[model samples]
Target chain A: MSDSEDVLATAAAWRAAGEPVALATVVETWGSSPRPAGSRLAVSATGKLAGSVSGGCIEGAVADAAQQTMRTGSPQLLDFGISDERAWEVGLACGGKLKVFVEKLA
Target chain B: MTPALLAALQAAQAAKRPVALLTRLSDGEQCLWPDAALPGALAEAAEAALRDDAAANLTLDGEAWFVHPHNPPLRLIVVGAVHIAQALVPMAQTTGFAVTVVDPRRAWATADRFPGITLIHEWTDDAMRALAPDARTAVVTLTHDPKLDDPALDIALRSPCFYIGALGSRRTHAKRVARLAEMGHGEAAMARIRAPVGLDIAAVTAPEIALSILAEVVAARRGAALARRAAPAPAAAA
Candidate 1:
């Protein structure tokens, strides 16, 4: 199975177990982003994570947003880049821009 | 996220059929297109995504939907566990191909030589029948023996394998062509076999030959369209 399939399967399992789940996907990338546009990360209500969005640079922020999306059941579109002043804050110093979409999974 | 839709996706994936999951970002309404027969505007987008073997967020009717293409893994079947096969297996694996090395000889097709690669201890014809090379598969014959290589080529040429190569010299390939012709294979069909297999790289070593063969296979797989685009157009008839 592919990485996306594994993440989706895990998210499905979590949802079946009555735990809330959220999926964060890198919808777009510019410059030297570590992961491609379709890279995904699955977050469960208990803080369990599967897959990755950025090679450890932005997973923390994505996970945080994913957890919040799980709690509030709302989607979020996040942008991070070296040009942004908050790039160092989010740890994306790879000289690239990434647009991630986080959504709660039913 | 319905149980039925999820089951369908899993079933399609397990069967090695091409599938795409179209998920609307706004409402998260998901639709799975197992084959080419998608509905309306989505069909064109799904076909393009499948053809490109890429996943993207496409906008249609002013709505955004993520078209995630879930294609089956590409496979490489190498007949003859020679030195080139030894080097080619790992390289093909690293390049995202599920490789299988086939050789009937027990000593040659041993696990000690191939290490973690999949080894088939059966004749080429038998192995080819069992594996059933599809369009997403590539077959390479390195045995240099007509007895072993011809049978594999017969099956590979008949199948939808994207790349078929045979390791031999020009004179050997000429003899092979005559032999295959006697078996009723026409010029067009025989043309598909890349004898003196691998690109025109001045490769003298086994590993270098394997690298050239792999480069040719990749070129055949993904570069055919580009080649067509770059080819000069035929003159128009008066």
Candidate 2:
């Protein structure tokens, strides 16, 4: 199965098990982004995860955003790029920029 | 991201249907294209995204929408369990194809030769019937024997499979074409077969041949402008 399928399946399974779930999707990408648009990362309330938005460059930040989205039941559009202040820490090594949309599963 | 919508999306992917999830980034409002026919630019964008198996971000009426295309996994059906297949299978898998090897020769089609691949111990025509090659599927007949390759080609020609390649030299292909013609396949249909079954890379070894074949398959899938077949080597060169 493709990563997209696995991520969606994991998100669905987490929701079915009564654990709150948040889905993070790469909505836009520029330069040499690790993943393409629509690549997904699923985060569960219990900290389980599936798939990735970047090649381990910014999953931590996205996961934190996901948790916040779960708490607020609101979606967030996150922009990450080398120009950001946190670029040294969370920016992609390939120097790509991406926008991730995170939302809780209703 | 309602539970019902998620379930529906999963169901569509599981069924290997081409689907697009359109999300308006402003408010997380989502709808699946084809749930209802989309209008204007959004519809064209979704159609292109699905066709190219890529995602796109479009601004329609000044509202940003992301169209995420979930296309079915690419499938390859190799109608031979030969040496080139051994090399081609792994390469194709690495290139993201779910491959199946169909051959009745139990001795050649054993797991010892093609480990971890779906093996069908049946005639090529019967196997192709059951597989039902779709637009996402590619069919390659590596068996030199006409009995095996011809049947598969006949079936593939009638289906919507995107790629059909047969392994042979020019003379061998001419004979195969004549036979297929007798089998009622027209000239247009016969044109679809990529005989000599690879890019003209002067590949001699089995692995090299496999690489060339896989390259051609990729080219066909991407709708690349394939180079015209190179003429056979000059007789004086021999």
Model 2 CA deviation exceeding 4 Å by range: B37-40, B81-100, B105-122, B129-134, B157-160, B167-220, B223-238
Error of 2 at B101 (Å): 3.8
Please give, for residues B1-238, the per-residue lDDT of candidate 2 as tens digits.
Answer: 9887888888888887878999999999988877757877888888899988899999988899999998877999999999999999999987778899999999999999998899999999999999999998999999999999999999999999999999998788888988999999987898888888999899999999999999998898877777345454432311
For each candidate in turn, the TM-score is 0.70, 0.77
Q: Pick the candidate with the highest TM-score.
A: 2
Query: Which tens-of-lDDT digit does each residue in A13-85 have in candidate 1?
Result: 8888998888888877889999887788999889999989998898988888998988887788788998777
Error of 1 at B77 (Å): 1.7
Top-lDDT structure, candidate number: 2
TM-score of chain B of each: 0.81, 0.83
